[model samples]
Target: MHNGFMRVTALALGIAGALAMGNAHASGFQIRENSVKNLGRANSGTAVAKHDASVVSNNPAAMVNFDRSAVQVDMTDINLDASFTGGGTTAIGTPLSGGNGGDPGSATLVPAISAVFPLSGAFDKVTVGVSVDAPFGLKTEYDPQWVGRYNAIKSDVKTVDLNLSSAIAVTDRFSIGAGLILQRADVTLTNAIDYGTAICTASVPGNLGASVANCLNPAYPFRPQANDGNVEVSGKDTSLGWRIGLQWKPTDHLTIGASHRSEIDHNLTGKADFTAPSAVAAVLGPRVADQSINAPLTTPSVSTISVEYDFNDAFRLMADYQATDWHSLQSVKIFTGGGGVLGNEPFQWKDTSFYSLGGEWDLSPAWTLRAGIAKDESPTNDTYRTPRLPDKNRKIFSLGATWNVSDAISVDAAYMRINVDDPTINGATSSSGSHLTGTFKAHADLFGVAAQFKF
Candidate 1:
């Protein structure tokens, strides 16, 4: 009984480790679809653009540029296609039997809203704003019996952020702003469990007197790939963070802006459920039963610097650079009810950077045209890459246009195409004794529209 309990404990730890592999539309699972106007230019000048109420989320300090109350609503559709071609896969020194998983990526819709209101009377120099957006989210589902099923079958994670901010124009040329961030995160992960390998690899004798020799016997009912179990883990958490921004207009044609958002930490508490073969369940007993679990996850912080240059009334140029503190996510630690450490999954992710250059041209009195290009770096390398997130460096191209329906209302539409560098997984091993080797072809497309109202 003691040995069986230990084996189950190890399996539970492995299940918890899966929580660390959430995919994202942006680098490192971060989402950048908060503003359609910005997306039109590949997010260039996001921190300095004061064209709409989205400034409330991009750079609160830019709110000072708004002379009246305004509201903006945006919707973005992201379509991702990722497929894996298996080079080879094995479990416990035996070749795994299964075909490559079909396309796991799916389409997702992201929405954002923001409002800014300027103060009256003595507070004339102050402006307040609010924004609601999904800062992170992604989902991937693979065929149940795929070659890499042991690594991951399904991964879904989502996060929402609410920001309340205020900006003060200290002087005509300088402005400062700060905001409070309320964020919520939810996750669900699933994977196959090799019950046969678990029993044979047991360091101590199993309750059923099962051993390596028994597993190797042709007549044995339970052996690698013969009897498979499944486990699913789900959790949710809410946390708080903060951000600050600065904007300076040194000259009439040039504006510079910078912002920093702090990291948010979450202590996710949830349940782990398992479905084991009848025979395996009988041997493991309560160890295979459902139990409460906890995991620690910290979203990374981000810093951005942007500049917008207005050469003349008809044309403007913009550039932006951003850095993500992905190193903060070095590892994910899982714990049981009594603060007992289950295991730690190491990611060793490095920090990443993003760069973009864009420009806008006034085509006519009622229309404007925009175009841009950008490059994003991936945080993971070949050693740590997994099928759940198979991220890689990517390039972005975007085109957009805005129609000025009237002085008080305007509509912005943008489209983006992302080209991802094919990533190769070279024998990445999992704690469950499964080694997956493959290559992935991936790409994404985004379409967005926004309406802005000023009152």
Candidate 2:
């Protein structure tokens, strides 16, 4: 009974800690599709561009550039294509049977909204704004009987952030701002469990006598993938963080801005449900029963510096650099409701950086054209990469346009293409001693549109 409990706990915690972690459209599962204008320029100058209400989420200090109350609504569609080609897969030194998982990526739609209000009366020097957006999300599902099913079958995570910010113009050339962030996240993960391997590895005597020979016997009821089980974990949490930013206009045509957002820590509590074969369940008994679990997760902090140069009324140039503190997510530790530590899964992710260059051309009194390019570094490396996060460095290209229907209303549209470097999985081993080896070819396309209204 003791051995059965330990096995169950390890499998439960392993899936809960590792598989439930991260994966998304952006590097390290972070989402950057908060504004269509920013997307048009590959996110360049996001912190310094004081042109729209989206500034409320990128850099609150930019709000000082607005004098009127305005609102913006945006919608973005992300289409991802991720496919795996199997080289070789093995389970407990034996070749595993199953085809390569089909394309696991899916198309998703993301929405964002923001409003900025410039104060009057005694508070005329202050500008306040509010924004709601999804900063992180992920979705992937592989075939149930795929060779890598033991590693991960399906993973879904979503997050929502609400920001309230205020900015004050300290002087004609300088402005400072601060904001409070409230974020909520939820995750659901599922994976296949090799019951044959579990029963063979168990130390408890009786039944089949806990031997590999018995497990591999043709007549045995439990043999490798022949009698597989399943486990699912679902969790949710909410947390708070803060951000600060500043913008400086050294000259009439030059602007520089910097911003930092703190990391939010979440303590997620949920249930782990298990389904085992009848024969396996009869032996494991209550050990395979459902139970409550908890884990701790910390989202990374981000810092950005942007510069914008307005050469003339019709032309503008911008560039920016961003850094993410992904090293903070070294490992995920699972715990029981009574505070007992189950185990931990190590990620050992490194910090990542992003760079972009963009420009805008005023084609006509009512039209503007935008173009940009960017490079994004991946935090995961070959040594620690897994099927759950087959991340690689990527390059991005974007084009956009804005139409000023009138002074009170405008529309913006943008398109982006991302090319991800092909990644190889040398021999990612699962908790059940399954090794998945393969190469992944991946890419993504994004389309966005936004409408702005002034009151």
RMSD of 1: 2.8
Residue pairs with colliding backbones in model 2 are none
Clashing pairs in 1: none
Model 2, 1-455: lDDT tens per residue? 22322222222222223332233356878888998988999989999876678888889999998989999999989888778887444454778777777877777788999999999999999999999998877677888988888777888777899999999999989999999999998888777877777676554434646667866688876667776888787778989999999999999999999999998889888877888889878878776787787888888899999999999999999998999988876777767566766445567889999999999999998999999999999888898677887888889999999999998899999999898888777787665667888888888889999999988
Best by TM-score: 2
User: Backbone collision count in every prediction?
Assistant: 0, 0
The total number of steric clashes, by the backbone 3 Å criterion, in model 2 comes to 0
Candidate No. with top lDDT: 2
Instruction: Please give the range of 10 consecutive residues that has the lowest summed lDDT in model 1.
Output: 5-14
